[model samples]
Target: MEWKGRRQSDNIEDQRGAGPSMGGSNPFGRGSGGGFRIPMGGARRAGGGMSIGTIIFLVVIYFVLKMMGIDLLQVMGEGGQTSQPGFEQTETASRRSSAQEEETKAFMATVLAETEDTWSGIFKAAGETYEEPKMVLFSGSVKSACGFASAASGPFYCPGDHKLYLDMSFFDELANKFDAAGDFAQAYVVAHEVGHHVQNLTGILPRFNQQRQRMSEVEANQMSVRVELQADCYAGIWGKYTEQKGLLESGDLEEALNAATQIGDDTLQKRMQGYVVPESFNHGTSEQRRRWFKRGFDSGRLDACNTFQGDI
Candidate 1:
C-alpha cells in the first residue's frame, strides 16, 4: 500500500490497446454447467495449424487416452494447448481519462515488482531459480492462455502460459464500483493472482484439475472456493513478509481485508443481481476470503496456508 519509487518488473507486457481474439473458450470455465463455448475467431497461429509431428503426436496420444477411457478432446481441451503470447492488432488509440488509469498502472508495476522480489527470494532460498512470470496489462479486452477475457473476469494467472493478465480498470471497479478503494486493496489483487502462480509451482494446479475431474458440480465449485481462499491466504503470506521487512503501514492490512470482502462472491452477486446464491460461489464467501487473508497475514508461513487440507 505504501509502495512508491520501488522496483518495477521488467516482465510487464503492456498490451493495453491491443484487441484480443480466441479459438476455443469455455464460458463457464470448462465444466461449470450450462456449457459455455467460446466463439471461434481467426487463427492466432498458436491455436491454428498444427505441425505434422504435432498432429501425429496428437493421434497417438488420442489412442492412448482412448485406451485409458478418457476423451482425447476433453483431455486436450482441459489441458489447454500452449500458445505463444502475442499482441493482436494495435489500434491507433491513446490514453484517455489519463489521471487515474496512468497512476494505477505505475502503482501496479511497482506492486508486481515487489511480488517478484518477494517470491523470487522465497524460491531461491529453496534452491530453485525463480522464473519471473510476465504480467500482461490490458485496458478493456485481453488474450491470455486461458482465453480472451474482458475486464470482468478480474485478474487471473493463466497456468498454460505462466503469465498473469490484468485489466487495470478493475482498480476503479474495485474502488468506486465495488467500494474497496485503497492502495493496499489493489496490491492484494496482484498478490492473489501471484498466489495462483505459487499454486502452479507447488503442484496445486494439477491436483485441482484432478479433483475437478472427479467432483460433482457443487463439490467442484466448493473446491474452487478452497483454491481461491488459499490464494487469499497466500496473499496474506506475502503481506506478512513485506510487513516484517518494514513495508506496511498501520492501516495497510485493513485495506487488504476490505478488498477481500469487497470482491466476495456473495457481495458481487448481490451487487450484480438482486440476491446471493451460495451454491454458485467459486471464489469463496466474504467471511472465508477475509479469514484466509488474515490467516496468511498473521502466520507469514506457507504451511499456515493449507486451505486445501484445512477448513476455510
Candidate 2:
C-alpha cells in the first residue's frame, strides 16, 4: 500500500481510447455479464446508446473482451452501434478517473519490480535464470496474442504473449462495488495475474492446459480451480514483498482476502444468475479461494502453492 515513489513500469501499452468491435458469448464465456459488458467495470469504452454505463453498454465491446479477431459492426451509425471508436469524454477516462489509477499503476509497477527481484533471486537460488514478463494496460479494449479483450475479462495474464493485461477500472470496482478497497487489494490482483505468468514460465500452465484438453468438462473445470487456487498462493508470495517494503496497512490483508472471496466463481455466479451450480464452476468456491490465498500468504513458499496435488 505504501507504493509511492516506486518505479513505474515502461511495459504498459496505453490503448485506453482504441476502436471497438462487437462479438459473441464472451467467446470462452467465463463470468462476463454479457455482450458489451466490461468484466467488473473495465470492458473497453462502453459508450453510445447508454445501456448500462458500467462498461456494459458500449457497442463493439468484443474488441476488448475475448478480443480474438472478433470484429463485426463496421458502422452501426451512432444509434444502432456506431462504427467509430467511441471516444466520448466520459468520467472514467477524464480527470475524475480517480487518483488511484496512477497510484495503482505505480503500485503494479513496484509489485512487478519486486516479483522480478524475488523470482530472479529464486531462480538464481535454484541455479536458473529468471525471465521477467511485461504488463499491458488498456482501456475499453485492446488486442493481444491472446486476441482482443474488453475490460470484461477482468485482469488476466496471457501466456501466449508473456504479458499481464489490466484495465484500471477494475480497481474502481474493487473499491466501490466489491468493497474490497485497499491498495494491497489492488496489488493482490496484479500479483495474482503475474502469478499466472509465473505458472506459464514454470511450464505449469501449458501442462495444465494440455491435460485439461484431454479431460472431461467436469474434470477440466476442476483443473481450472486448482490452477486458480495456485495463482492465489502465488499472489500471496508476491504479497510478501509488500511487507518487506513496509506496505502492510491494518485493513490491507482483509481487503485482499475480501477480493479473493468477491471474485469467487460461486459468488460471481450467484450474482450474475441466482444460484451456484458447482458443475459449471471453474474458479472455485469462495471458501476454497480464500483458503488457498491464505495458504500462500501464511507460507510464502512456492511449493505450498501446489493446488494440482492429488488432493486438490
Candidate 3:
C-alpha cells in the first residue's frame, strides 16, 4: 500500500485523548466474563428485520470476539446512546500522537482520500453525486449519533451521523492478535466501513432495515450476512482502484484477503468458542467473504456487488 505523500482527508475528526462524555441514564450491563454485554433495552421493533439496537449489538459481537477475550458491548440508552454523563470530557494536556500513530493517521487519511476520489468518479458516472463521509479518530471511547462507543466496540459507520468511527489501536490488534498484518489489511477495514456508508447513500441500508423487520431471527441474520458480504465486495472495488493506480504491491491483495478470512464470522466464532454456528453468522463465512471480495475486485462494477440478489 503506497499511501505516503498522498492527500489526507480534512474530514477526520481527531477526538483522541478527549475523555468520554456522558449522554444518557441507562448503564451498561456487565457480562459474566467481566466485559459489558449490550443490553437490548430501549430497542424498538423495526418493520421486518432487526432493530437498530439488534444490528448494532450484533456488530458489537464481532468487536467483542477480537478484543483479546474481552466483552465491551453496553447499552447506554435509547438511540444507541453509548456512555453515561458526568465523566470528564477533556483532551489531555500533552496530547500527541506517537510516530507510528502519526504514520497510521497519514495512511488512513490517504486511503480515505482515495476512496473519496474513487467513489466520486463512480457516482458521477452513474449521474449521481458522491457525499464523502467523515471519519472520526478517537481513543478509549466517543459519542456519536449512533451512541457512545468504546474502542472495544471496534470501527463502525453510523448511518445516523454519516461518519466512520475508528480507534486506530485496532490496527495493532489486527496485526498482533488476529495475525492480519500489512497496511492493506488496515485499508480493507477502512474500506469496508466506508462501503457501509455507500449502502446508506444508495438507500440500501434503509431498505434493508425496513425489510429486516419482517424477518425471523435466522432470516434476519442471513440478511445481515448479505449486507456484510456486499460491503466486502465494495471494499474489493476500492482495492481494484488501488491496484489500477499502481498503489498495490505484490502481497497487498493477499493481505486483504487474509484479513477477510481472519474476521469471518465462522473463523472468529471457532477461535473464540471452539465451534461454529452457521445460523448465528451475520457476516459471511471465510470462503464467502473471500469470494465476494474477489467478485468485486474482478469486475469493479457496482452491479457485481449485488449479494442480496444471487446465491452468495
In model 1, which runs have C-alpha deviations exceeding 4 angstroms? 20-96
Q: Cα lDDT of model 1 overall?
A: 0.84
User: How far out, in Å, is residue 49 in model 2?
Assistant: 38
**lDDT values for all models:** 0.84, 0.78, 0.89
Q: Candidate 1: lDDT of 170? A: 82
Every model: Cα RMSD to truth: 21.2, 17.8, 20.7
Query: What is the clash tally of candidate 3?
Result: 11
| Per-model TM values vs. the true structure | 0.73, 0.73, 0.75
Candidate 2 C-alpha lDDT tens digits along 218-237: 98988898889999988887
Which regions of candidate 3 deviate over 4 angstroms? Answer: 20-97
Which model, 1 or 3, shows the larger TM-score? 3
Candidate closest to the true structure, highest lDDT: 3
lDDT per residue (tens digit) for residues 73-99 in model 1 = 886675553321221212212334565
Worst 10 residues of 1 by lDDT: 83-92
State each candidate's clash count. 0, 18, 11
Q: Pick the candidate with the highest TM-score.
A: 3
**lDDT: the better of candidates 2 and 3:** 3
